[model samples]
Target: MQTSEYLTNFSAGIAPIPQDQWQALAQHCGPFLQYSFLNGLETCGCVGGTTGWQPHFITVHRHGTLVGAMPGYLKSDSYGEYVFDHSWANAYHHHGLNYYPKWISAVPFTPVTGPRMLIHPNADKQIIVEKLLEQAGRLEQFGASSCHLLFAQDFERHNACHAGYRARWSVQFQWHNYDYTDFDGFLSALTSRKRKDIRKSRQFLQASGICIERRGDGQIRPQDMAFFLSCYQQTYLKRSGHTGYLNQEFFEHLLKTLKNRLMLVIARQGDVPVASALFLYDDKGLYGRYWGSLRDVNGLHFECCYFQGIEFAIENRIPLFNPGTQGEHKILRGFEPIYCCSLHRLFASEFDAAVGEFLDREAPVITNYYHQAHNVLPFNATFRAQLISSPENKKGHF
Candidate 1:
């Protein structure tokens, strides 16, 4: 057999790559990895320059044909990445080392788990993934301290570990659908107490005259995005004292190119939208990415973000709903604890051994917490039994 030459190139953005070729591989990866969503991030100024996320998109070619690609960035500071590596950066600073400009393969601000090393099905999957990871870790050329692949999909986890990257684990709450027929069918799987609580919240919201409607694709008007952007920025300012990382430009771009994957859970009081939660979804799953409100209506967050998403998933037969990160409140609402993994390759032996030791110590703690959180889920006994036998739990995905 003749050997095929595989060529790889890293660029500051995906502009040089043909959009059709990129979209060919990205078709089913998810909304985050889609060319439009990522390129929109760069074009809208949500990432790049002083924003601390420097785009370093990687593309792999076979005989001049685009075969695989990875979205990456040269990070100056750990600001928008939800993986939380400031402690690692601080440790480096304490030891008289620089951690700034570490390379990462991720969806910039998105913490959702999806494909990182994307390859066409006809290509050699294992070799292409290995090639992509090996090239991504070539940080010495770029003066980066290390290379990390964040929120990587599970199939790539072993490939990464095989490529000499240390594995790190964290837990995010997610809701799963098991052939549910409707919203009430989902509630029947939960414990009596928790089921009643969800019912109570929904009923209360109904009586409060807050109409929650999901608008998507062409139904999303310019004013709707303007309102969503306003609520997003207001919430960010109230919580972090600044406008959010996203701007109107980003949402505008989304409306044009990625609107089909976008859904807005809007809460209105008599034709006036008060709060909005933006979600991205495809045939596979729904991701509750961003939400904000101009007025504080009781139980509005749960309805607009969680319940509505669950209902939509049931209607569309989507299998999963990942409602963002770091919310213990989600546990009581039936979101299962699932492990989200990141892989790292450090150039320096000292930091490699150090971070490896740190990860070794940290893994067990996160595992124990994941198991502990799973025990507290408000699922009924039968549902818990089903979950135990489900592939996600059987494979130790928790």
Candidate 2:
């Protein structure tokens, strides 16, 4: 076993971790794992200081070499974690046990999952995962009642189970690119009925004179970002009576530092931008992060958020498109349901078995729902056959 000293080094922030070292570990993970993106969250006041998200980043090093890292927080509340655990917290409350200050590793306010536990390519991954869990559990000493790893990658779920943490599964709708050449090619792969439905939606928007376009890489201008933030906040205010978790400075900070990975799909009505969505992409995937609008036009949301992302993914050859979370509407539009995982280890022995039992009961129902959701995908027979035979389905991806 690797020495415990080589693991469990926690810092209050990611700012001190050398950028090059962090990027080397994050390179294949995705753009959200980039040092700039993580640090931008802190530096821009989106997190830290009374946000209930106290940054508690972890890095493992061996002989002065960075080996692994995870985005962690000492969460006082569970508002931002998409892996809902409010019921668990309430359970603790009923029993007069504290659930606040649970340690978690996840990207803040971003539900489109990729990776949370980041490891260097050359490192002993199995060893790192083991030690990481040890350290997370050890946070109990700092008053953490439990440890949670949210939206972790699938293989990490297996590792966590082996390490004695109970695995919890949730489903999210995501799109998979199967070598399409363009938007029309993508539509061609869909069932005739669904294809016509999507086509009509597009035509309705096009005929309404709502122009949709995408800007990415260096083309996302400052004004474009400002417009997106306003729409984003406006929508949040209408729904929740507050601006979204991310602030204007956070947007600006990411724009300056991580703009290359950023994308904007803007919908305009005759030269006036009315709606927009923001995405983060790398060579691996296109992640739809946020979308908002000044005007709600017929079919505009689907055209801007889903159809545009599908087209971009096809053009860019990005193999996956995860358009945020919890939208069954996406299933009818070709997005398929897949399992997302979270791991929990409550320090209280009594609660541990209860939570474990709860998770076990929930897993099959969630998995069954995942399998059943496949029936509704808009794919044609050929595409459906391709999906059934695909290695992802065969592996079951849990």
Best-fitting candidate, scored by lDDT: 1
Regions more than 4 Å wrong, model 2: 1-7, 386-398
lDDT of each: 0.87, 0.86
**lDDT by residue (tens digit), candidate 1, 230-311:** 9999999999999888888999999889888889988988778899999999889999999999998899999999999999
**Tens-digit lDDT track for model 2 on 1-398?**
53755746887878888889988898888877788888989998888998999999877888787888878999999988888888889999999989998999888998766677888898888878776777777798999998888888877788888888888889999888878889888888888998999989888888888898899977999999999999999999998999999999889988898888898999989889999999999888899988899998988888888999998899889999999899889999988888788888899999999998888899889978988897677777886677667776653422
The 10 consecutive residues of candidate 1 with the worst lDDT sum are: 389-398
TM-score of model 1 vs. true structure: 0.95
Error of model 1, residue 51, in angstroms: 0.8
- The deviation in Å at residue 207 for candidate 1 is 2.6
Give candidates' CA RMSD values in order. 2.0, 2.1
